[model samples]
Target: MKVSALGNEIAGPGGPGPGVRLVVVIEDEAIVLAGYQMLFESWGYVVIAAQSADEALGMLEAGSMPPGFILADFRLRDGQTGTEAIERVRQAFGPDIPGVVVTGDTTVTVDRLRLAASEGMPILHKPVNGRQLQELLTRSFKT
Candidate 1:
């Protein structure tokens, strides 16, 4: 088991002994968030999950290390988008932090495309297949 900077033990059933990668997941749905947490941990990633961007930021301990990746639902509560949430976390950490936005919304507007492009983030359509997500994460963290 690995203890986090916040003193929380990090481990999951059938998971690797200690998580080497850290991921921040911003999802509004409780079930989805739980699933992501379980899935990420099982993949040997430590997950920080929250319903909103603000909540995720609040949960982080000061001076904690930056997450290796970020996954966020495009349409969040309180009129916030995944890109915005990613930017918020990046602002706290570093702008080079990579993130992906997952959305159920089929309609993609020009503004949305522009924002994601400008931020160097990719948008994935839901429901994201586990293998696809795993591939994406593996490819992303490999860089």
Candidate 2:
């Protein structure tokens, strides 16, 4: 559901104009997605919520608008993982684009988790905190 007040206007020869920030969220749960859409937007970020990896990829294929950041759920429908979803989005957007994976999987291995952290891909456990998300987003845009 659309909630962000980030109105889209045709940019010049490039994409969104300066000061325009977009956050793409990949989630399957309708209620959760809605909550996140509103939450991020409240922080002044333009948020887009995708229901699945395929849907996100489809939007990219169809030339959907690019995002400055991505937030995705690790365990998704059809057995797809959040890592895979983020990878595909980065491939389409850019490698430097910052993203975070939200999951409740306690069984995630340490090495993998460390790798994510080192790469600056924060792994946020479920029931994501608004403050943490704000801090992360603040830090992400700084770089």
Candidate 3:
């Protein structure tokens, strides 16, 4: 679904036009995914969202435009993790596609931190506001 900066619905599906920055959001929570989509759209970004990595991959056509950024919940409905989801999507697009993992799991072990660090994905605690997300995007992608 496409939403304009003014929060109006836009026609057409699939990838966006040339030079349009897209953000792919993977969140199991319907409310959270909708919120992210609205927030990103309000920021003038084209958002392609799904509840899981597999679902997102299925929705995206082969050889379609790749997203400029990715956001996924650290813990999904299944045993799949955000890192795994990111890797799966990255494989479809390219390894350079930057992504972030959001999670409410406060007990982040050292091993988990190491894993995220190795993948160059920053983890944001849950209840993330628009400001924090915007700042992180700015710092990471200079958007």
Best candidate, lDDT: 1
TM-score of each: 0.82, 0.79, 0.84
Q: What order do you get sorting by TM-score, best first?
A: 3, 1, 2
Determine which window of 10 residues in candidate 1 has minimal summed lDDT: 10-19
lDDT of 3 by residue, 30-58 (tens): 88888898888788877777888987776
What C-alpha root-mean-square deviation, in Å, does candidate 1 show against the real structure? 5.2
Best by TM-score: 3
- Give a tens-digit lDDT track for model 2, residues 52-104: 76676554443345778889887888988777788888888788889898988
Structure candidate 2, residue pairs in collision: none
Model 1: residues with Cα > 4 Å off, grouped in runs: 1-19
lDDT value, residue 82 of candidate 1: 92
Q: Give stretches of model 2 more than 4 Å off.
A: 1-17, 60-65
Error of 2 at 129 (Å): 1.7
Candidate 1 at 18: error in angstroms?
9.1
Write down the lDDT of every candidate, Cα atoms only. 0.79, 0.75, 0.78
